[model samples]
Target: MSDTTTNGAADAAQAPQIKMNVLAQFIRDMSFENILAQKGTGGETQPDVQVQVNLDARKRTPDHQFEVVMKLKVDSKAKGSGDQLFLMELEYGGVFHIENVPDEQIHPFLLIECPRMLFPFVRRIVADVTRDGGFPPLNLETIDFVSLYRNEMMRRQAATVPADDSASA
Candidate 1:
């Protein structure tokens, strides 16, 4: 084979390749609570709804697989009474088979891309469960996993910095 042809084949073999295979997807845990059920439906005033979201991922031992979990907590409280209205907490997870990814890129692949694949399903479940519980369906906004991951990295970096060096020496 010519030198140029040989080098072309070698380059192709070394090129980076990535794949996401969902071996299984399931809800690790989920709960919905209507604390004010007996108190009757909310009045003309709309309740304040608060939401918190978290994403975490880990590699399964002795394998190239990983598990990613996304948690969403929604709390709605009456505007005036402050009495509890409804609370929904969901923990959604998926088992992923990742291969041919470099070590430096694995983290983002798991945290950003994996949960991305799972977000729509989780969103649907939240809406359905809330509707079934008698409240208006809660459709969560589309999450930007990339932004979340970057913010987490920034927080971690800040945490590692020494605090108040003047006090040390």
Candidate 2:
């Protein structure tokens, strides 16, 4: 064979075969705190709690790898006294292997499927943390990941749309 053809074949053979495999899957780390529950006494003071949930995901590399983390913060206080009763924060995350997927497919898997897969674990962590913190288990509301991701993409696209006749043309 000609040198050019031989070189082409060799390059193809050396090319890294990209196959996505879950090299490892586990909770890298976790933290849950309930300082208020520890400090105050159990009373019939009708406590009120405000809870906030934040979700975020990021790609660790250009290849098939990503991390999805969910965070929950709950602030509780006595209804009348306004004294802090309990504060709990739970942070949980998961690592995913996503390889050989085209750019178009990557977004869906990263935004939708990865979060869906990680949600149950994160939810469980929240519940367990709250229970351990001497409060009723926190059952998180179910998330519609696909819709959430699509809405985010649409919002971003809308924000970047050129604003004027000149730009449009």
Candidate 3:
């Protein structure tokens, strides 16, 4: 029993603890074009919006520090008339300090976890930009980062298979 207790303590001591912090966040680029304002509207129109998301990450000069960027493209159209309403593109970036994560997991962690931490800010910016552009505030739904990461991985795998097959032939 004493040996078991000592082994458990040793295991606990040997386990690595994860530490993470958001060092900074900023909008790397942003653009908004209000098409409705450019083209005169005749009557009330309902808005239909579509949003696309992409993520990128890179290591910084400082040890354990990384930069993650979330890119968003939003396009809106009139539901009834099918006329273009507005378009917005934003690149939001965050600087993060992370320690003690296993090397194998760092890729997914940067793509999923880092973006998860920065999502709320991205949502807020989308809402504010839409409202300021003369449309109703557009609230974004919560994104599933894990699903996104999985889909991206699958896409990358699919893209590489053909190249690998060609090389072998």
RMSD each, Å = 3.3, 8.8, 1.6
The TM-score, computed over Cα atoms with residue i paired to residue i, of candidate 3 is 0.93
Over 65-87, each residue of candidate 1 has an lDDT whose tens digit, in order, gives 99999988999888787778889
* Model 1, runs deviating above 4 Å: 1-14, 38-41, 163-169
Q: How do the residues 1-169 of candidate 3 rate in per-residue lDDT, one tens digit apiece?
A: 9999999999999998899999999999999999998887645688888999999999999999999999999999989888999999999999999999999999999999999999999999999999998888899999999999999999999999999999999
Q: What is the TM-score (0 to 1) of candidate 2?
A: 0.61
Model 2, 86-112: lDDT tens per residue? Answer: 676766566778766677777677667
Best by TM-score: 3
Deviating ranges (above 4 Å) for candidate 2: 1-22, 25-35, 38-41, 44-53, 75-85, 158-169
lDDT of every model, 2 decimals: 0.88, 0.71, 0.95
Model 3 accuracy (lDDT, Cα): 0.95
Ranking by lDDT: 3, 1, 2
The number of clashing residue pairs in model 1 is 0
Evaluated at residue 155, the lDDT of candidate 1 is: 89
